[model samples]
Target: MNYSPELVQFLGSLVAILAVAGLAWWMKLGGAPELSNEKEAQAAASEAMDGFESVETAVDANGRGAILRDRSGCLLLLKQHGNKFAGRLLTHSATGRIDKDKLVVDSGERRFGVVALAIDHAQSWADRINEVRSASDA
Candidate 1:
């Protein structure tokens, strides 16, 4: 079959574009990194939750998001979406509980998302959040 030059060029460009797109998806080019250290986790938290004056404690949720408590008894949930971070401030009414290895933060009416960190200290985060929540109540 004889192929026109225009068709050939168009096919080549399409293939190139597909290849680039595949590479980006494979490498997660604009995704959040799996935080392995406190500093990196803090940076991700800061980027995800702006205006966080100071971070008292932080935990990574398998690179998906972070559970952070600020100095002022604020529980912040930072979820990474593509290259951007979506943040939610868990109010004092929000209750925290651990189901298996995941810490579920929920309120009576609405529920916040869950963070699945590979760390072994899921309970620690839940406890801290509960402590802060209770403190604010008192």
Candidate 2:
């Protein structure tokens, strides 16, 4: 069997191209679901605190605070101060727990999977007030 140099070079180049393309696809170089997920989170945040206005946005050495507020009182403060998630329901100090693959925030009085996001960083008891205001407003 006689083999040509040009044919061997073409095969080698084809293999290299395929390997590079596979790696690019695996790494998601062209922006995939990861980017969409971030946009989705932002949308969720907005939906969670619908009536609130962004009063202040701060990100210092300590952490980040995207403070939002409503007409009557403060709403949920999305804080990134050394926490697991980007933002959590910031009404109480108690940690979030899981119940049958669901998240529950135990604030002593109530324990629920979904709590309406209320005012952010307006007052000390802003979260409590927000819940009340939201109920009344609705």
Candidate 3:
């Protein structure tokens, strides 16, 4: 069999491209295991709230963030940032809304920015957090 140098180089480039594409597909960046149950949610919550001693309660569905309640009954929004997770405590004045599949929570003037949760049950999370906020007010 006879092969031209140009053809060999082209084949090599194609193979490299395919390999890279395959690796990216397999990696599933920003993808996490489904948090269908309390146990899985707790695990994600724990990872998000790294310094927290324990996660008393948590709500999550296969995605970016989780609503966590610590041992002190403090509500926190746990979100992924790069290789690690960060958390923002939900204060009494905290407010939230569901825009599409995202739960946007603003911890009033004290907190610097908004915490957006991209999850399956974004509305449910907003509702739950609002319910907690109302209950706390009462």
lDDT of 1 by residue, 11-125 (tens): 9999999999999999878865455566665676677667675465455546666677777767777656656666667766666677876776653334344544444477777
Query: Candidate 2's residue-wise lDDT over 32-85, tens digit each?
Result: 221123333444346556543434332212222333334444434343322222
lDDT: which is higher, 1 or 2? Answer: 1
Instruction: Pull out the clashing pairs in model 1.
Output: none
Per-residue error at 117 for model 2, in Å? Answer: 19
In order, the Cα lDDT scores of the candidates are 0.66, 0.41, 0.67
TM-score, cand. 1 vs. native: 0.56
Worst 10 residues of 2 by lDDT: 56-65
Ranked by TM-score from best down, the candidates are: 1, 3, 2
Per model, how many backbone clashes are there?
A: 0, 7, 0
Give per-model TM-scores. 0.56, 0.26, 0.48
Clashing pairs in 2: 74-119, 74-120, 75-118, 75-119, 75-120, 76-118, 76-119
* TM-score, predicted candidate 3 vs. hidden true structure: 0.48
Which residue ranges in model 3 land beyond 4 Å of their true spot? Answer: 1-44, 47-63, 69-74, 109-112
Q: Which of candidates 2 and 3 is the stronger one according to lDDT? A: 3
